[model samples]
Target: MGRWEPDARGRLLRAALELFAEHGYEATTTAQIADRAGLTKTTLFRLFADKREIVFQGQGELLALVTRGVDEALNDASAWDRMVNGVLVLSGAHAHEHRTTGRILDPILARSPELNERAVFKRSAITSALEGSLIGHGIDRWQAGALADLGIRAYYSGYDLWVAVDDSSTLADHVLAQITVLRGAAAQALEAAAPQPHPAGVRSADG
Candidate 1:
């Protein structure tokens, strides 16, 4: 693709965000977004299915990147390691790309329940893709589903924290850190749930 081709999509995305911020998501029309971008409605439609699609178009690419990462991981890697690797790959692919767009998009999503629902669906799609990849690598289906959920949760948490901070670490580093935190929490919960012996001198409250 030409340099200008990428610019066209960026322009439309930015224009749509601005209009949504100024008016409202429901009030902002595709024609206005195209006009703001200095492109025709036809050109806008060529790049996106609709206004919602413009906001979510990158999700498909992210899913593909994560899936490729899972597929190419070392054969001996554990399921959790493979999931983390996929998230790291996704972070690398989108680290610097979405900061500005996210600043604009987050508030818009919060304001509209429709947008929020769509965002949840997009996240679910990513988790589903990751689960499928894990299953293909020979992991049990149920365990793979749980690991995928964890990976996606870590990804979004890390992404939010990374974009909000002015840290020197890369997005992948933040993602790994989030995954570590989640793992620690899970371990602690498991430990707490394990049965423990009562002290010899201790009496039960009921006794």
Candidate 2:
């Protein structure tokens, strides 16, 4: 193998995914991934902290993008509006480029509990970051948290749909559509849970 290589990080990530798929996450080793990429173990470690990190590359960038989007929204914007802006920011930047890898990653994470846990942790971290940003903008904590959860769910669900479905829409389009769906669902749930008024002539059994 050459001492210098182009796209080493990309190579390592693809190699790791392939090995994890073939032999399973726990069964695959860093050295095997490195070898599969035609790179050295030292090169792999230089690119990633460990075998697990390879699968989660770009998490930091996404979190930063999410924070930026929410923070930059108009001061008077509603929490849900700010969340939609955040989803648009991140998904527009990353979704198209990541579609191919996302397709491969979804099933691999589904098969591996450890990898899926890490994926969930990364998402939770993004949600927390978004909530903090909303609070910084003077939004109420409860509303901030709820909007954060909904925002993250919308972004990811949109990404999943983008990867699974053959569509002409961009990731931001998919994410925005999902946000609309989630908002409608939340509305229905609240309406269903609301107490209905009793008829004027109705009497309780206790009464």
What TM-score, computed on C-alpha atoms, does each candidate reach? 0.90, 0.91
Poorest 10 consecutive residues of model 1 by lDDT? 1-10
Q: Name the runs in model 1 displaced over 4 angstroms.
A: 1-6, 198-207
> Pick by TM-score: which candidate is best?
2
List ranges where model 2 is wrong by over 4 Å.
Answer: 203-207
Model 2 collision count: 0
lDDT on C-alpha atoms for all candidate structures: 0.86, 0.86
Measured on C-alpha atoms, candidate 1 has an lDDT of: 0.86
